[model samples]
Target chain A: MNVDLIDLGNESRNAGSFVSFLDQICARFELDHAAYAGTNPVASAVHGYVNYPDAWKHHYAENGLHRIDPTLLVASRSIAPVDWSRLDHTEGFEKTFRDARDFGITNRGLTIPVRGPYGDIGMLSVTRDCSVTEWEKLSRQILPDLQSVAVHVHDTVMRSDVLSRALRYPALSTREREILQWIAAGKSQQDVGDILGISHRTVEVHLRSGREKLYALTTPQAVGRAIMLGLIYPL
Target chain B: MIIIVDALNKDRFGDLLDEMFKLRARVFGDRLGWEVEITNGREIDQFDRLDPAYVIGLDDEGHVVSCVRALQTTGPHMLSDVFQVLLDGEPPLRSATLWESTRFCVDTQRLCRDGNTMKAVSMATCELMIGSLEYARRSGISDIITVIDPVVNRVLKRSDNAPYDYVGSTKQMGKVPAMAALLDCTEERINRVRAFAGITHDVFANEDTVRDLLDARQLAFAAQLGESSEWMAAILSGSEEALPPVLPEDIQDYCRAQIETAQTEEEHAAALRLVAVLVRERVHPAMHRLVFQS
Candidate 1:
């Protein structure tokens, strides 16, 4: 394999440029598709650009497949790139793979996990529809370069203004933070309200607002997010 | 003494690896302020997950004083991934016989804490150099492409273990400028570092002896911490509430070793206090699952 050094220094910075970059990578490496997903540390939300079909994207989100997507769940936790073949064909995998095959997406893929300084994780997943032997050869040949590309994509996305803003901690009021901290320390809503010299209903209102700001569904989830973002300390 | 920790034997040296990560956190995260992830007072990154070999130096009390990470160049490495800017427009070096050495650091505060001069640092540095080169030579590795700062580059020259060649120009990385230097894994280079450090005997620690010593220390620490063998067995057998969910088994093992080998009463108390702080903070969410699963 004639591997040439890839230069990303001159790549244009724009909203659609990431898609173009992924398209270029797919073309150069003879891949069917390339996708990049980065988790925003502050909100714990995932956002990225992918070259897969929009129909598949909508299907994936609508079905909440990310919750069980081995490429994301298993790959994000690992320090190394995960080969799709190495993942077990569990019930979730079968569902995802069966659905993906209908969209002409093969199971032969690799997901390279990139960890940033502040505990953020970025995954670059690429797929190729080819014979098993061909995929093995191609993956082996491109693994090193793909790893570097994964980091480049991650760093670029992390530096973007949108991501930077998302990375910023949600601004929580002092009272709200105190309430959450107390709640995390096993205080009840009434106890927090009493400690803060407020009504229980007012405490509930503050918890609701904090939960909204953190994009959490429950008070405990909001408290967890607050603790993770360093907005509140755990007792 | 120098010890090589790789994937095969990493389980046996979990405590040493943890200390090495903490040392890296101090050097790269705290002192240098590099864009590196630090969790639970340890600096660990994606590359560390790839099972890279670590050449570490431990003091008499088994404190990890100096360390460097070596990764196979054929796989993804710092030079190709994080520090590609230093490569200019050139292709990243990839070869089975060439390893990329990076994250080279020494615990300066610990080594020089007693008002020791540069002697301790230099000795440790030379010992590491000798250790990595000899290990590489034995493993059939031909050359090492290291990403080093200018200060380390100068030290390499001063110790007469300088690189034979350079690749790509230097670029400012984090708080310091870094360049890639290539060093051959040869007897001549090893001899130069050994001669410079005046280390004639083997620098590698005897694995069996080290394990025995550490095991003995762990027992002593358990006794001093008021934890009996029965308590340890209970914890090991999954006694609820005895061990905190946030404390991973490996970290608990490491703390046990630290308490056992502590030189002073204050040191032993400090180790115990650290465990308290960790349990209180519950700093790492990932460690929670590890504890529960273990």
Candidate 2:
């Protein structure tokens, strides 16, 4: 796997080639499936290729499972690789996994999170169906190599033209942009509303929409993005 | 102040890291004449994409004065990949407790301009050394194998933080000779470096101090841009989480992410504040499940 990673630079040129790379990885490691998902920092859209069964992929997309998939939700937030067995079997996890089992997917898996300097996050998850002890030993042995692979895959994908072209900046409305600018200038929502002669609730609405458009999970993040995108100028 | 920037907090210190990278470009690509890739005034390579921990020193005004890169030896590192020639014929050392320290540099030009050139450079260098060693020691790293030139080697020895041994014989690389030297992450070593620099207080900056400095800088920038003073005053008096209320689930998810990625003591405190907010919002069930389950 380490040797393969050395040549990953030449192989993974686009999403299609990356899928083939994942297939080769699954075959070499004797894993059932290998999946990679990453949030494109510029576009703020999720993009990647997975080697899961077609039906399961379709089901996952139809259900918007990425938002609640424990493998992604939990792992993407972590700096360390997360073992599937350690995840909490919450309602979302139960729904996702129970359906996954129907597709002949094992609940046993490992997800390695890779973070880029630009705040982009990539997750490489691999699952192998086997006895508990065998799974544990295999995961333990391959953890380091898997971590390297995750970084390689993420850097390659980030450099790919496919992702670069997908850099669609979300268009914020005039009001949204104005509110974000005020926020970036250190104005609170109430102050912004009072300055703009709008109700505070209306100010909140615009800020919420601005955050959604920016794909920012927090207001500070939204303000940061707005400033970076030049929608708001702090200086 | 020396700060350790890793995958989790890299976003918070992006500008600082950029300054460090630009310093690397000046030192490695220009000064040292090494064949390093320099793009947009930043010297960043594939290893940097792997999220290596960076021990960076910042002056009172938050300029990157010194920096070093640390990558685990258990995976691909400069010694195993880029500088294999320095390893002779022996296989690269790979161990969970070992890390490779490379790209160690100081902004001698900037430091020298501040005070006595030699004193400033040595102080920043020793501060960075102590910072990396203490950080590595806390993170359970036992040893560090660093690639450095003879000049840095001499400085290390003079500071009493000399490498305990050498990995391979020195070889001429680019304009200078380079060697791989080994250093143990021990209390005595940190103490020696601290003593040499006459640094008694903690080298690592308090998180709140860092945050306040950054905020002040931002506010100053805004003021310089002609932002209304009233708005700046309001921000100054505003609570930390003064943004519009997000959904409970969103808050919970954000808090969970914060908790999972928290590394430093102050980061944990911030995460705890998020948990407290979640509890106050009556979103205890989901937060409770996420917290206790993990």
Candidate 3:
């Protein structure tokens, strides 16, 4: 099913239309259920919508199923469309799966993981009750559409914090920030090593980790990004 | 195809573990002259019992062509236990999110030809790497500390997914010198390997499929060479079942020619054993040259 793309710039208006958009998605796909869950690990905020039986979402939140839900676990780590059946059936999961089934969440479904620009993880799962064979056929028909729609839904409906979060920039250690600051102030790697009382190779390691944290392409870029992020100040 | 195996699904790995251990012996004990303990033609150690995750790359014929092992850094790891000499007394780095990747090797005979480059080797190596990064990223690991030799280091750089930095100074580990190298477990790293390999799709197969494909190949080989001949019976016995992967056509022809040229029963048996191993583990095209020369 298709819904008109809402203007994300109008935050309040977009927020209000999100439920209708989700409803349209379920209606078009003939899906019995749908959900869009977002987790900003940096901010420790988990919020989502699941059009399941009443209070099920609240119960799931109260129980903190987000930490152990196999489907969400896979969605967080992979940029893939995880078939619900492919998840691990570990301790405590059988009950979760059975309880979900009790709520009309079938054994067969698909969850498309969306990694946001600021490193937030979210997923859009559409579920229906059907035999494995029928589910496979339906999946083949709708997978491409579902993947595109998942990304669209995540971008449009999910709250994004691009400027502040920068997609969860890896938190740099104090020493790492200091070394990067020195590098930004025209110090060579060897110079930093001498100043820090560590080996030059150790300095290189910190610098490399700094670059990786900032997702920088080189030493210069890493230093520049560090300064821009206020992780370090220039001389 | 690449397969991911951990303690949970390792039971479905079939003959791959045996093949990997034998290959390790060949590379470490025979070729590199490492001081590893090899018994019954297999190089296994205490680490194998630790239930480390394995990323195995198999050729189209179901032969394992490349393999690497990963262990949680928070637990006892090879670098922490045995390779302490390399660490220089620094406490082994441990974290819930950091992993140790070790035992990285490619079947040079099968993949590389002129001891330089081959399409299969490059593809297998890159695929194995992609598999490792994907596995790590999904498991919430943020970094990988691998005790890699210089040759592997160069290969990683060549493949465009080099380690971000080295952790310790180089030290001699058996015949080859090695260093602790660090690679960030990130999608960007995975993308680099994927782009270099020109792969755009997932390369992983479920554990059962891997077991079935390998079992079917071995059963077919058993059917082709029934346990009638004494030599075949001896080599194919359960105690000595470390036979190589199914042989290619040219190598089969070469083995037949060598068998015909045998002058005695003992010579024939020796030639048969050598031929069986050679066909299964031919890492390079020039291996025949070394065999003929010797």
List the DockQ of the predictions in order.
0.01, 0.01, 0.03
Model 1 misplaced regions, further than 4 Å: A1-235, B227-268, B271-294
lDDT of each: 0.74, 0.73, 0.68
Docking class of 1: incorrect
Clash pairs for candidate 2: none
Q: Which residue runs of candidate 3 sit more than 4 Å off their true CA positions?
A: A1-235, B112-117, B227-294
lDDT of 2 at B115: 60
lDDT per residue for candidate 3 within B100-198, as digits (tens), equals 898898887767654657777788889988888887666445668898888889999999988777765799987789899888767788988899989
lDDT score for candidate 1 against the true structure: 0.74
lDDT of 2 by residue, A119-174 (tens): 56788899999999998788766764565566657655765655553442455666
Q: In model 3, state the lDDT of residue B243.
A: 33
Task: Return the TM-score for each candidate structure.
Answer: 0.46, 0.47, 0.51
lDDT of 1 by residue, B1-294 (tens): 898887545778998898788889889988887778898778999889877789998877777889999876534688768887887754465443467899999988888877998899889888888889887765445678899888889989999998776667899887778899888877888998888889998999987777787778777766665633443444445563664455677777776677677644447678776665655466346456676789
The TM-score of predicted model 1 comes to: 0.46
Give chain B TM-scores in order: 0.77, 0.74, 0.76
Error of 2 at B291 (Å): 65
RMSD for each model, in Å, please? 22.4, 25.2, 14.5
Return the top candidate by DockQ: 3
Please provide TM-scores computed only on chain A for all of the candidate models, following their numbering. Answer: 0.63, 0.65, 0.59
Q: Give the lDDT of residue B55 in candidate 1.
A: 92
